[model samples]
Target: MDESDGEALAAREWRLIREERWPGPMNMALDEIAAETAAAGGPRTLRVYRWEPSTLSLGYRQDPDTVDWGYCAAEGITVTRRQTGGGGIYHDSHGDISYTIAAPADELPGDLVESYRRLCTPILDAFDRLDVPAAFAETGRPALHDPACYLRELHPAHDVVVPGDDGPRKVSGNAQHRRTDAVVQHGSLTYAVRPERHLAAFADPSVDAATFRERVTGIEDHADVTRTAAVSTVEEALAEWADAAEGSWTEDELARARERANEKYGSDAWTRRRPGDR
Candidate 1:
């Protein structure tokens, strides 16, 4: 083969992992595995997953105490923390889709914000293909110490949003955690609004639920887009953008995720971190 053809063949192709809905701990464990695996020269990946029984995920440095424990206990909501930084998100198995892209850091841009923007090309393309008219947030002003991820003013550069008459309602929220030689970027692509109280009850017991729902948008809100369609759209986008080949996980990656679950994700010592508590 010619040198150029050889280079083309050597280009990294994505391994697709369409994981079934799992617990918050295992979900996060898999993400960590994505990062480490990519750093170790594993194949690039596009992973899709969901949360079962509904779960609430907090930012890396966020205070777990910000959540109203009584509310969660009464409602049976699973509380966990993400490896990436951001506000807390309520992962509804029946309501949303979660996706992540893992590749060598060198494959991505060096700038933090730009890297975030670029990694989303496939998602943006997917939305465009679906005629959803979604784009990145134009302004990413920080939230006023709010624990609710949806409550934060959409970080224009960091999030994907759908424009509407009411405002720019965020459709997806993304964050990044860089490994030595790899990068893992994950986000939630919701299709419908959660029960306002599901998020409000824990984020702030006093906030009205209906108002919170207005701050965000779901794929279903426009064009009645189904999760299945959204997933397919994204998969199409990935294939078009990267020429990625579909594949599955290696035994080593699964083992790493399992080990991470035992030591980090599954442990309250890691998830339940608060200001003074640990």
Candidate 2:
């Protein structure tokens, strides 16, 4: 190996992956690839991606039967599952910025809560740069995990929100999946929220449209933010805060992701698989 090759290999490097085209299955597969690889002594990766035709992404352990398949089918909305645990989310193509940040477990705090907050700084900083008045929620989480991530108000320390007369309105929904080798945290930032649209697919009679509106507020609704602007702001600030060097996926990474998609994420056995199903 060349002398420069040794230097490159020795230095701890951060990688940024921006996904321009990926269906629900491929996206989830890629996130898992990053997590598993990092845990196995690969480079850390931060990913920003978008979904096409929108998608309803279920939490890892969430019962797939919770959603109305007939409604989703008729509406042409696809359903997928995440490697992380949180409430399901509607990734609207028009109004959401999705991101995943993963690193080896040793690089982050052992305390899960502390690590979650640390990863959120980039997003919170992006909000500040956009001049969006933001703060972490000061309230506590629900006693039980809400099926829909947007429905369950996130922990005040981890969720970024804007002030409201009623309370802090959540702008971002985050969740974590801790692996033996890596800690992956990913989330959605809504530029616009059509709660009625999302609720129609995921919420049952237990949740009403009014309640959904009250709990979640879109960035656009709260400010003049657009999807492009939000994404750009995040790309710049998040990369800087995390000290990442923009990069692309390696061939091996893509191959592993595609293999994972075929074996798990795209399969019925996995998408609908409940926790401990194995």
Candidate 3:
């Protein structure tokens, strides 16, 4: 190997892949690739991406028929399923930024719920930076009965909420997928968009947007700042958190990610893979 190769190997490195803003499927596909890469031996990565033209993304387990296709299409929204399980989310450009964290499972807790709290702390710190009074929804029943991720009350390490006279308002929605090798946890940081759009996408006919908003709060709604400022706040907070944490993936690892992305994530079979596909 060349002398420079040794230097590159010795230096701690992390790959940052920021492709042009893509649609929902592309973003999810790339994140799956990154996770597989980590699983194989690639350095842990943080992929920040946006859905262009906006779209409504459903959790992997959710049935497509559950979404209001006509309503989404009329609003120029594209629909796709995420690798993670959760309710439908109407992603609007300029309203939110999404993050996917790919890392080895060894670095996180064994229990899925515990892992969520640990990962979400930085998000709480970001809210603290904004001076927003936020806390994780307490763990238990209320958390489970709420079908929509954003609608659920804070759990030990779930979403963030701003306490109010009436109750808590959700400001973020996050979820995780734990693989044998790595974990990919992602969530949306709400910005300028209306929760009504997401509420409308739900198949449930009885839900009311006003009532939901009255209970839920986006980052923009909870903070005493501008939307742009909140976005920057989260960016910086996550960066700091990652920096203090030490770890790096090897080149061979990235190659594995490519293989996984192409074979699993990139394939229609995997993208459309359902509950019993295994």
Better of 1 and 3 by TM-score: 1
| lDDT tens digits, residue span 68-174, model 3 | 76787798876767778766677777777777777777766798777786677667888899887888766433542243566655555666667777776766778
Q: Which pairs clash (backbone N, Cα, C closer than 3 Å) in model 1? A: 137-156, 138-156, 139-156, 140-155, 140-156
Cα-based RMSD of candidate 1:
3.6
Give the lDDT of residue 42 in candidate 2.
72
Q: How much lDDT does candidate 2 score?
A: 0.78
Please identify which of the two predictions, 2 or 3, would achieve the higher TM-score against the true structure.
2
Tens-digit lDDT track of model 2 for 1-278 = 23553344336667887656587888888888888777877778888898887888988888887787788879877789887777788888777788888888887778877877778878888888878788778875452237777767567656777888887677887878888778888888888878777887774737666777777787787567667878888888767765678898889989988988888887889878776796
Worst lDDT run of 10 residues, candidate 1, spans 1-10
lDDT of 1 at 15: 78
| TM-score of every candidate | 0.89, 0.89, 0.78
Candidate 3: Cα lDDT at 177: 86
Model 3 lDDT-worst window of ten:
1-10
Which parts of model 1 have CA positions greater than 4 angstroms off?
Answer: 1-10, 140-145, 200-205, 276-278
